[model samples]
Target: MASSASSHGSINAADHSPPPPPTASAPVQAVENNLLTPVALSSVSLHGAKNTRRSLLDHVFKPLVRESASADTTFGDVLARLSIANQKLARYDIFKEDSIRVFISEALEQPQPGLHLDCTNLDVSISVKEKSRLVLSAGTDFGNAEGSAYTNAVIRNILGGAETLSVNASTGTRTRSAYNAVFSTPVNGNPDLRLGLEGLRSSTQKPWASHEEQLTGGNLRLAYLADNGDSHALAYSGVWRQLTNLAATSSPTVRADAGDSLKSSIAHTFTRDRRDRAGNPMLSQNGWLLRTVSELAGWGPLRGDVAFCKSEVEVSGAVPVLNSIRGGLPSGISVGGGLRMGVLYPLPTGYSLTGPAQPSRINDRFQLGGPTDVRGFKQCGLGPHDGTDAVGGDVYAAGSVNMLLPLPRAGPESPLRIQLFTNGGRLVALKNKGKAGEGGPTAALDSRAVVNGISSAVCELADGLPSLAAGVGLVYAHPVARFELNFSLPLVQRRGEEARKGLQVGVGINFL
Candidate 1:
């Protein structure tokens, strides 16, 4: 895909630094004076413009999704009813500006909405070389809330693995327009340690403060690794970012491909308390962890994370022995607390680290699925408590999957990717097997989401299998240009309905 996230800002023409530190969390190739200086459009941009893609609003989108004027349906009915006879996917254009339109649905085209954006651009310009290996990406994001901006880049796949570096950048106001190359050479043919830089420069748009705000800052990152073809791998990264009118957000986790063994994991993020790079505010918090398996099998590919969360946050972080299984429980639970901030993907205002608000889409992650996380009942989650007396920590380990078959060929730029998938997860407290349906003893955690206080109670009282939903949508291929139309879909329906009304569709970049 030729970079699609609206290129608004100008690029910086100067080469500010040598290649970034071998391991910077997220490094911004220092901007000269951090100034908003306008310059002539880059020659590369005119080349891009000449080759610009046709608008998605034209032929392709119209034929893909359209309006069916029904004799029996009102605008509301037409909005509520899809062709499947009473089964409606979503409402349309609840609000519309001259160039923008919207849709609302409970479920996405199909499939589960994982953590990362599915694809960066509607045009699929990136592909693995061999199709045998899955490329894992690690790096940092930079931005400035004081200005408006956009950026785009590509990842080259070697042997089906993402192993090359490519990029494009621009600010909203044409203040900067330059591309910085880092880690140009594929590191040991390993996609895990791939170097990628994502940043933003946004200026406040007036009259949006009530609904949206402005934020400007820069975020950058570098990641690389050496893949030995068999089991061993080495990877690292670092990021440095500042926000002018910014909002805080949750922590991020680096992921591994499915079925691949040979374990390795080490990643975390840091933030300053202030809005800009200058140190007017205190340091908020930081996160880090490392885990390597002596033996890959049965180790289950160990994973860990530490984060500086919001003040409403109860706790965060874990101790070393926490991963050590002693009598079936970790030695200790992670602990820390204070007013954590908010950082949402594809933020609402160019200034804040905001994501789509509550009524729309939710892409922020709190904790993994388990006892303390989503507080409910599922597979085999029952065990004893090991948390501190005051901390109130409980344990529940679980796993689940969701699948879907596309009515269409799954391709890179096809705006509509649909399929069906089911998901499941469970966590058990080695000591206490809480009854199903009853939830737990406490009113807060002890609700209907729990087991009836016994085994078999899990399936007996429930209406059907342990299934909820999986949502999907489009994400501009580039990482820095936050133009994500995050979406989702629901599986089961409500009473008197053969299908489900549980579906929810909003605009946010939360799908994995």
Candidate 2:
């Protein structure tokens, strides 16, 4: 009978016909006879893993193959097992690349004298090229919120455990200065589970909002990855926040929430990402992302300065358009758009909106504006403003639509593009804490009076409607960030609202 077998340089497999049933006529063969039987892992050799511990590799590889004393494994089964092990090793991220080779080998011990040849065993050899363990990087970044120079030092394969440690620092005009250190490691020897700790300090000046904030915090995070390309993370953070340098023109509401406060909360984030690349998505790709953050303060040993629940959902997709029209437009031209909506509601913690002193904090409020947000408006330019400062709002909604056009020489992989976009959004303060004094009149503590007061506040907030803007821009989607120069005009505006007209330049990791 004729048989065929295929093998690759990186992986190997062989097919063998079972020896003719022990012919009684032939001389009794040795127990070491070579016959077609399931293969057993005899030994494993690792190359180029100098800094990695042998035990670590064993932990990652040992469970991958079952050790069956009975020889009943086939060559194909060995290949499949090696493939799975290779994937697990790649997830460590310590290696530039890795390959596994499998081959048949003789068992170490002597065989009984009743068989023909040496017993066959499977041997797995893993070869990996370690990536640089340490790296130092520095660069300058520009964006609508700030322009800054940043530097970072990173160490991989920390303590030979495939862990990572990094320290970063940055200084800029709007962000002032910031520093952070982070350490991450696999959890309980599971590559798919991770634990991280972070320490951070930063100071930021918001010129559009006329306030400077100083923050010092530490966080602990745990993350898990599922087989379906989904990830979940849970974190606990405690920080001391100080808001100062409030301009004299700042609103009374802003001044009330200004001061040092403690924010201790727990948050969870789930993400399902299927995009081809995260940095700059392809024009013909389709993907959606949903993030919901629920935060609770004063849960344990921390101060309950603020409490709120915020959730946001965004979906984006791209499709080929005008492709059938030969001469009408370029071949790669496509239309891409996304929808985003978010809501923020303050949780009651005995903090009365109508009290002499409210517990709600200003830094916790939501602010929307800038070229990355609602374009055609200055930074924090949308929503309600206190004098010239944007105080932000308790509730806000924003949506945008955009068209992406390929540049003259742009290819599917090229990041250059021309884009046209229109954005609209609204921000509103749900209850007027400024009217706390008004509840002291006829029915001071009466429920009827409280009901009327909330009605009045809602009525006052109705003055600010949704604002709309449209613009055209040059977008360069780089692997690390996106750059844009746009010219925008507001189609609708509110009196006293500051709108950014004409050319506006922005640089950041995301575009709204």
lDDT of every predicted structure (CA atoms): 0.23, 0.65
RMSD of each: 28.3, 9.4
Error of 2 at 381 (Å): 1.1
Give the per-residue lDDT of model 1 (tens digit) for 223-342.
Answer: 432232122322232222121221122111111100112212223332222112121111111232222211110111222111111111112221222335456442222222221112
Alpha carbon RMSD to native, model 2: 9.4
TM for every model, in the order presented, reads 0.23, 0.79
Return the top candidate by lDDT.
2
Clash tally, candidates in order: 116, 13
Give the candidate number with the greatest TM-score.
2
